[model samples]
Target chain A: MKRRRPFLLFTLLAFGYAFLYVPIISLIVYSFNVSRLVTVWGGFSTRWYGELLHNDQILSAAWLSLRIATMNATLSVILGTLAAITLVRFGKFRGRTLFSTMVSAPLVMPDVILGLASLLLFVTMEHLIGWPAGRGITTITLAHITFSAAFVTVVVQSRLSQFDISLEEAAMDLGARPWKVFLLITLPIIAPSLLAGWLLAFTLSLDDLVIASFVAGPGATTLPMVVYSSVRLGVSPQINALATLIVATVTLCILLAGWLMHRQETLRRRAPVIDIS
Target chain B: MTTRATINGSARNAGEWLGDLLTGHHGRRLVIALPYLWLLVFFMLPFVIVLKISLAEVLLGRPPYSPLWQYLEDSTVQIQLHLDNYRRLWEDPLYFIAYLKSLKIAGISTLVCLLLGYPMAYAIARTRDSLRNLLLMLVILPFWTSFLIRVYAWIGILKSNGLLNNLLLALGVIDHPLALLHTDFAVYLGIVYSYLPFMVLPLYATLSRMDLTLLEAAADLGCRPWKAFLRVTLPLSLPGIIAGCMLVFIPAVGEFVIPDLLGGPDSLMIGKVLWTEFFSNRDWPAASAVAVVMLVLLVVPLALFQRAQEKSEGKPPL
Candidate 1:
């Protein structure tokens, strides 16, 4: 208040954002640089991107990661939605406290604990039931869903708690069955949060390195595994390009999700009728 | 309607029965049980399995450890259990150092995050609505991207010949490239950089929702801005601060990627130790023991969190 300009605050804000964005921007810029050494910028070129496409290992790992992420996200949504529904719609169910603990526990559990435990689970299951054969994409997806679903449960639970129960009761009163009421009323209402949850789960699976590393076996190397091994050696231009592409895709998806959510909120404010559809 | 009546009445009866099975109390019960059952099998079972393995002795053969039970004739029973893993963990100085070191790093990084994040969160909270949304989006966008890649980005920037050093040299600020990468400082940087969003979001939520009138009232009472902030805003946002710190600290203690990527060989984190004990050392029992101990160590904080959540929700906690 004493000073006309809050220069210090502005500088801190700028520095914080710069600290956040500068590294990412640098990674993207160096991806375009036609040089073996990342420090030296030869010129702007798409040579690395071209090289990235030709790399078979990167391509296969990427496809594998995508398949796993999609499956993980879908399963997470199904399981987490059920958990959220149980908590919010079904009041005071048996084992409510235990259920809450289990649902929320994984949110803060370390990836190391999760990875080790799940790996042990898979190994023991294989010995007992001769199932899962050997760890690969299937094991990875299971490991991912275990944690991601907890996250989905949190997201969906928050949204569910805020929802007006009257709408669902109204539908039920109009001669709709419980399942029908849920399908016709609750599902549509929570679809945005569900989408957010799914996207969140997908991103989590895609980004995971430590857990996936532990669970994955032979011929099951994921994108992160590839990047991890490559990064351990050194930073290659190809990885930079791959990272830039990932950044672009993720930013686009997030912005789109934000826009969709904002639009839904605006529409809901304008007319409550539109929310039902 | 007449044509519908002509159809078999048993079909409608069956339909209702099926619908009842799908959407009735029993059906809802099934839906609730599905996730619970999954967690039981995957989450809870794993801990049990880890505990069991920790109790058993390591073996050379495939699948390693033998069954813990050995039943004999004449009503005699023997248990093939060993406390060697736990004993080893206690005997080894490395484990103690690693635990202490991890806590120190996690704590320091959490503090740095709070200092850095408070201003950013306040800036966003004080901004207009539209701009605030955009700024918040920017804060979260980094989170959407790969965390590993963000860590990797730090490697290039902090490398001796990388961008930061190059810029410093070109500006004549430093005649030589400093040894910035592969140090505890780099580990701190990586953790703080990556976990900043987690710190900012909760703080912003609390700060933005704070009633400005409280601060105004404090100012009217002859409180300076700093005093008003300490008296009013800080206390109000304490919950968020606690939450953000917990969120950052818990994961940081078990972080493997950041420390492994950015830290020097001297940086001994429990996560990395566990990884090596499992994979490199091939000591599954020891690794399981490490995990169990870590879980036990975390149980107190986690219970506190659950209590905090229950209090906020204003429910009778179980």
Candidate 2:
């Protein structure tokens, strides 16, 4: 019943945030260190960033990862939206239990299992059908899509469930076809969630390492793979630079998204109400 | 339904039938069928393949696992089910210890995350809307960054002569740099850090939706604030607690990166074991066996998580 914030809880929150951000802040700080050693601070410089830029392996891997992430994001949004529609709109179809489980299970399923199982599937498919020929970008993208779509589905499903069905019904009653109603009424309303889903899938695919490692064949390496190999030997300043870049990009994207959503919210609030009656 | 009837009654061409299928009841079926078939083939069927592979012998072939079925020279079919993979998993103390350690590590990390995250989530949930949004974003912002990178960041902090040690030395907290990285403690720190947001978001969802009036009633009934929280808020947040714990515990159990990066040689998590089996040993059957067993271990928690999700969503249990 106390409306005021508790001091202990607020302190805890501060500590929690500090715990979360300190490593990141430090990582960013060390990225500019001139010294090769990660722990010690030599003078501040951008040498690692320069080294990172010139590293052909990291660049090629980053390019490959970006391609996979883009394809995975686009494909996941489609699959996830359909899955969300099935769960939230279809209403108690046969195998709805299994369908729902399949849609969400990937979110919590271990990445190692997913990676291993998917690799096995591709191997079997290659042996049986002789299609896909061998694992590469295509296989990695497919594996990413499978799990990333689950994340997208969760995002879209929550939005779809909150949607007002009567809007679509009203459009339908006014002589619009089902698809037309969906396109004109439902799509616009859920577009924000779709965008969120797409971004989530994209980031997930980009960040994935274990699954990509499992499914990637010889010659196909992702950014995370390169980072993992380098980081394993010990922390490198170039990796610190790469991490700083990733953190900066992600932070920028999130802030932009937040601003866009806020603007949309304000515009919606300011819009005059339509009196159809 | 009427559309289907009308199409059946009047459709005399493939185009009409296709249109009906696209726009009518069958279209709904198609929407459901696409993702369903995709998951069935890619998600569910892989487990079946893993099970089959788990039953096969390790081989010196390209695939590295023997075929489950073979056609013999004579008029006979040979079915080889090598149960040794599973038997070896049970018999081997290395795997047994790894599984136990994985569960133990995941359990402790989940507990730690819950402890650290609950108050944070509650604070955010109880805040004004604008501040709440900003706070929640802060919590999730790190999550949006690369998970591997975030985990990698800890190495600099926890390693010998790392930031923490240097700071500690300067502060006279300890004379020697602590052996923090590549230890069980670092693994716990990494898991808890990475999974804290997962715990917080779900808890905040439940906590924010909680009715303050109930707390008010408890307060009016001569109850202390802490007691009111214990009796009312804690009980109400059980679903979130379960969901959050499951979310943290499930993947953490099979976490490969945290352990591989931060854990010492003694940290024998099943995920690391499975990875070594598949990649280092090139024993697909052993890896498949490990996966099958891990799935079995997680089946209960996974079900619990699904139920909690359905409950939170106000959906009927299947």
Candidate 3:
């Protein structure tokens, strides 16, 4: 029975990983197919990659998406770090429940609802104050920041909550002000989490299609928006090339992050202990 | 004391007061207020607008919703509230069925994810440290990839002349290509594939943290392995199960990309319904009403998920 259980588990694990990966592997292989049809491979070629590069619509959309993602990630990291600090450091502030709820609620909120509501809000704001003027990059970035900040807050909050308070207190004891202590002691300790949060927000903003579709105006087409429109017309080799590029880039980033983390671990272990005695 | 006196004396100037408020003792308040106000304006205020728009009549104008209130010539306010949008949702079986169908699909998908994910998570949790980390990274690696790309990959596999059909035909498993794409089954496959990581991560977390000694004690007490797992591991992992299920179910219910890309015309999910109402049909009021109703349906589970999250704040969530 014991041997059978391990075998069952191993099989299940193998199947699970295969289920997750096989489609991606097949898609990667087909990206190089010379034929227009996805099923038939007419030898290998880089023609689709060349075509993708020349597609003006896709290029512009990718540029717009990159800009929006950069802006969203930067703003989300700031707001998320503040929200995390509030939740972790502030002890029993007024409206704390509501504050925490507002911070976390966006994580599970449906994209359709969030999109519809945000679009309505932008319209109402425009009608009332005429601040935004119209929906475009600004509106989509704002919408992305709102939800992405929630995810960032979760990431930062977990790290902050586990942090030791004595480090900050020690900095304060050495005559550093509260802000200085936070900047010098607290921020450095939690910088890794902040980076993770930033990357997460960047990816989320870049990948969003539904919310961006709702909040975006005529000119501001994101990469996902362009991809969705083209994908609806059925699978194309260009999209496959684009997908392959995205998958490869992301995999490379993850591997780089993993290697950096491992090196950091080794460096920390090798550091000489302070002779406090 | 001298610095405080000087600061109080300088507080007569607005710039000094503002600077003091930002960099001085009120820094804590600034930290709390910034994100608090951002969410209030962007996240919370939008829901109020949705509720307001849901009560307004659909109009053929720029914003596409009639005014809820207007000042008459006599300066008396006339309030116009049209509940027809909500009423239409009730009268029209399409909206009702879509909600039901979304719930059914999300529920079934969540269950399938749990069944498939639980064992994998358990296996990973039981592995040695280095292998476990590698396995966990493998689960998260797909999650970091583009969601649209993942869903799009299935189209190439599920279409009539797709890879799966071709492979099956070559193996002589089927005489003809079976209809796979644009089906309810395809939607299920997409949801399970996409959300499987969300289920596994949380389950792995709680399962890894579980006390294995209790299982050993159960076995020593003459309990069979299955019986010990039922009593010890399964019950112990209930929180993870709930967390994992909610993570999968909440998003799956309102999932737009998966259903739209993979589902056929007959597959009526509320997210697609809402999308069509807003984008294709250009019915803002109706879409707002649909969103408000969907929010109402999800509020309880969302609150429960938050409570669980608050209870486990130090632990990271996927």
Candidate 4:
């Protein structure tokens, strides 16, 4: 029984994973179907992709989403980096506990509540300051930044935890200004983690449906919103085609990230040992 | 020269004092505090707003507007605050029933994920060193795909005449295609598909970190393989089980997409209700109330779980 256990376990594991991915594989395969109804597989055709290309609404929504995601990702990284640095280095100050909790709250808080509260915030900010005057891509991007930064902060914090403080101290001792030390020594080491965090933020913002729906105003529909509305109309081959492309792109990115991380780990392991005389 | 030395001495004193202030137990407190503040402001504050709105009446499109004293004047308001929503919720049996249904669906899905993910995580963890990283990476490959697209893919698989049915029919197993789409079963399947990786990763973390010495010792004592696992391994992995449950259950309860996409019209999870109130109905007050109640229901249990874990571990809960 013990000898067969591992093999049994592997089979079960493989089956479970296959269950997870097969639906996705099916969707991708059927995206090329010429048939409109989901049942029959007509001869393979790229008509859906052709239709998607000319659909101005979908293209514009995609562009808007891309712009917002890019902005949100960049802003999230900057703010998250600052927050992570402060949390790690400053360690303790007045209301530190409160700040820590607030930062993490976004992670577990229901998306519906977050979206509603953010919409409320945007409206209130408009009333008070008469700035960010309208709800559109700007407000939506701002909202995404709030939660996405929280996520980035978590990743950056974990990365920073494993980092040594002495690297900064050594730079400072070698006649480098604080900014210079951060730029030269600290930033490079944490670059991969920062990149990872940015990617995470970007994907989250891009994938966001509930929050984006809440904050979006006229002319700010995203790819998710489009897909959601279209799904309501009924699942079509166009959506399958879109999903296949997204899944393919993301899978490629994940593979690249995995390879890059592995290379970095191996390089770190093989780094020449310094002998202190 | 004397002044300069004195100034330098004082500066050095201040630096040491700062260092002392943040060292040892005090340092851990400080390190943990920032996260606490963040949760308090963003997480705690939103709930506070929800609670405040839940109490007040719907005047216009905005949340409640009643002053605290005015609210107090109606003695009904005191107890009515809680009763108002609960009464409203009770009046609509649909809401309560939906909650129960959602809980049942989420609960079963979490269990399914545990069964599937535990073996997968174990297999990956027990793999040879060279293949371990590759296997683990493959396991998480789906997560990088957009969540929406992944869920969207399910429509093709679960539809009436979809892939599963097509394949089954070709094999001559059944004369008719099974009704698989727009069912509670489909909802559960979607949820488990999405959340399985979450359970696997945590279990993997704990399992890989597990020391083999105890298991070896148990085996040496002539315990059967299963008996050794029960006595030595299972007990050590309870923490991971709890963590995985929390990770799956918390978000699963609030999930909107899976149910909306896969579930039939009768499927009415609180998340979808909340969305409908906000978007379709445009009743902001009612939506806020629902959002408030859901948060309360969710947070109380989670807090209790955290407290329980803390008590067991004999540490303050993070």
Off by over 4 Å in 4: A1-5, A86-97, A164-181, A269-277, B1-44, B59-86, B304-318
| Fnat by candidate, in order | 0.67, 0.75, 0.77, 0.37
- Put down candidate 4 lDDT per residue, A55-157, tens digits, no spaces: 8888888888899989999988887876676676665577655465466556656678788777766655576698678889998887898788877886786
What is candidate 2's lDDT per residue for A1-277, written digit by digit as tens?
Answer: 3476679999999999999999999999999998888888899899999999999999999999999999999999999999888877777877988887887689899999999999999999999999678999999999999999988888888888888788777776777666666666788788988999999999999999999999999989999999999999988899999999999999999999888888877886897342222
> Lowest-scoring 10 consecutive residues by lDDT in candidate 4 chain B?
B309-318
Interface RMSD measured for model 1? 3.4
**DockQ preference between candidates 3 and 4, better one:** 3
Higher-ranked by lDDT: 2 or 3: 2
Question: Cα miss at B13, model 2 (Å)?
Answer: 15
Question: Candidate 3: where are CA atoms >4 Å away?
Answer: A1-5, A272-277, B1-25
Top candidate by TM-score:
2
Give the candidate order by descending DockQ. Answer: 3, 2, 1, 4
Q: Give the Å shift of residue B159 in candidate 3.
A: 0.5
lDDT by residue for model 4 (B1-318), tens: 999999999997776566555443574465455445444544455566656555655555333333232446546553334336556876898788877876787788889888888888888877878988877876677766778778877877778778788888899998899998888888988899888877887678677778987777787788887898787777787766766666677678878998999898877788888888777877665777777677767775465445333332311111
Steric clash pairs (candidate 3): none
- What TM-score does each of the candidates earn? 0.93, 0.95, 0.94, 0.84
Please give the range of 10 consecutive residues that has the lowest summed lDDT in model 1 chain A.
Answer: A1-10
* Candidate 2 - chain A - TM: 0.96
TM-score of chain A of 3: 0.94
lDDT of 4 at B252: 81
